[model samples]
Target: MCWEAGLSTEAGNSVDPRSNGLFGVYVHWPFCAAKCPYCDFNSHVHRGPFDEAGFVAAYAAELVHFAQKVPGRTVQSIFFGGGTPSLMDPRSVGAILEAIGRHWTIDARVEITLEANPTSVEADRFRGYRAAGVNRVSLGVQSLREGPLAELGRRHTVDEAVAAVRLAQSIFPRTSFDLIYARPRQTLDDWQDELTEALWMAQGHLSLYQLTIEMGTRYYDLFRAGKLQMPGEDLSADFYELTQELTQNAGLPAYEISNHARPGQESRHNLIYWRYGEYVGVGPGAHGRLLINNQRHATAAEKLPFDWQRKVLARGHGMVTDDVLTWEEEGDEMLVMGLRLREGIDPRRFQRISGRAISERQIAELKAIGFLETLPNGFLRVTDKGWPVLDAVVADLAA
Candidate 1:
């Protein structure tokens, strides 16, 4: 299949069928200084020295491999996420970006973001990264309070986070930071104060995530043992509502349930995910979503560093799973992701990808339950009332 722009096609067919014009690239760095107890993101602590040069060479080769697989697709965004991407040497980042530029045609306005922990060591390298083609930085300043920082196992102090943000603002054109709300023993008033402080410090974008105890996390174990004491459901709901109200009043409305941005400042790379666009994931434990010849496919990379390195060096790739999504599965995914956004999902696009529309019966049921509102633009968006009970709404749709 040949896309517009005279790009040629390969022999194999796409795994799943979907057509969304945009595409992105995501590079996951699986090494962190230390793994947070609540993190289960395939990240491991780098206790000893590792081969940075070898890793860079492997990543370059991986990019070449992907370029061959999906030729002629213009890259709109590139995100370096993970075990603290800021830990990467600026030169390595530069080399990877150079390799990407050589392999694929990138959009001139492409948003290349790197996630960093708000430590002085990382902050000092902000300028070096900017010079290396990283235009955006998402600082992992999970909280600005000392107690919460300690609880979350963050290395940086509140002062360090503030300083890092200040440095990031000076260095990068686009800067965003994340905060984890609804912590154990956190009150609504406490969160309100924290959010206010964060908004004052924020340059543009903010990702306020509620702490959830996922299976395999330390928090989950603690909860199972009845040792965890996070905010109760009622308190969590209060925090969530306060977040929506506060961010809206600040003119940084919630574009997604957990993400807030001033108009036109939303994270473009994230938008690729929420909008169901194609993205390539590289490095250990990373996942990629791709569309080729109108077929959609998902890629999961090897979970361990040594394993991923070996696979990349041997087969020129580190992919563990490259499964194609089914139409119903794709529809369900779209519903799950799109509904997270304030604008919701486009009915036409949903039908195009899912092979069926969201049933009117389901829609009526959701509206009757005060969970959704049909917009004039033909999108069914989740109402504020619906957000607090998002899981129930999703279950209703699935049923």
Candidate 2:
């Protein structure tokens, strides 16, 4: 079904961008120089030539297509995420930004961000990207150690990663980099030393993720073959607890489970997702949540890069999935995303979305078990004790 948000005096048609809460845009660039063994993101190694101009035009058309569906809102954030957005030409990025500005009333303080992988060549382009209006940059500096970098199939060395981070910090007003701990052979002492160094390099924000073995990745194949060994339950928990302690003491607290940031430095684009706000996802394999006729519709695009570009050029969009979420699905999703945040979820908003009240019996059980708590302002949050088993808590509550 087509989701059309016409300009009418409807409840969702709020002109003030902040009036309707946060609105954002996500652009996915689907090419990468090389594929990592542990990566499961929709990325590909495209050989031969890439038509940057054609892809840029397709992106612009896709933006206009979504603009028609959802209008009269200010864009608070725009994120270029992907295989490796740093591989993109700066002019192409600027063109996409121009198209967004053309379609939406961009907020004066819009947080425009691009995700990059740390390489010497990509580092050289940092200034060019900043000039293209990308004010924030997140580097895929997965590790600071030489061994981890090679084991993870990263092309950049430790020195290169550091140089890239330093360059990105000097160029972008807001900069953050990622680190993956709990690797196949990573020890507690190893992670501690690496994360401490990371904390020193980090300016304001850091995306610290625990290594998970997802199906279909090379890591998973090796793990099944008994070649890749991961941390056990007790060791994994130790690593996590140590991470929380170190980052907390360093003054960058965990605002979200996998992300730590200084106060006021949280990624606004990511918050649009965790806070359940509306955004448009453009390009290959990008997923989005949008308000269509006051209902939340989940959308996704074609996965292959060339195929997505072809579809966008032919039909003005590449969306292959658009499902209007049911109340139960919305509630489950709210719990899944919102409970990851330290500030937690508002029960009132949950009620409004799901049209049902949270079970008081369930809440009491969780609270008694020291897994959950209610804030003085009536927000229900997962306590630190509950966080290690967050999925189970969310499942119990959703049930």
Candidate No. with top lDDT: 2
lDDT by residue for model 2 (135-165), tens: 8999999999999899999999999899888
Off by over 4 Å in 1: 1-17, 120-124
lDDT (Cα, 0-100) at 44 in candidate 2: 92
Off by over 4 Å in 2: 1-20, 120-124
In model 2, pairs of residues that clash are: none
Give each model's clash number.
2, 0
**Against the true structure, candidate 2 has what lDDT?**
0.88
What are the lDDT scores of the predictions, listed in order?
Answer: 0.85, 0.88
lDDT of 1 by residue, 318-395 (tens): 998999889788888888888899998888888888788778899898899789998999888899999988877877
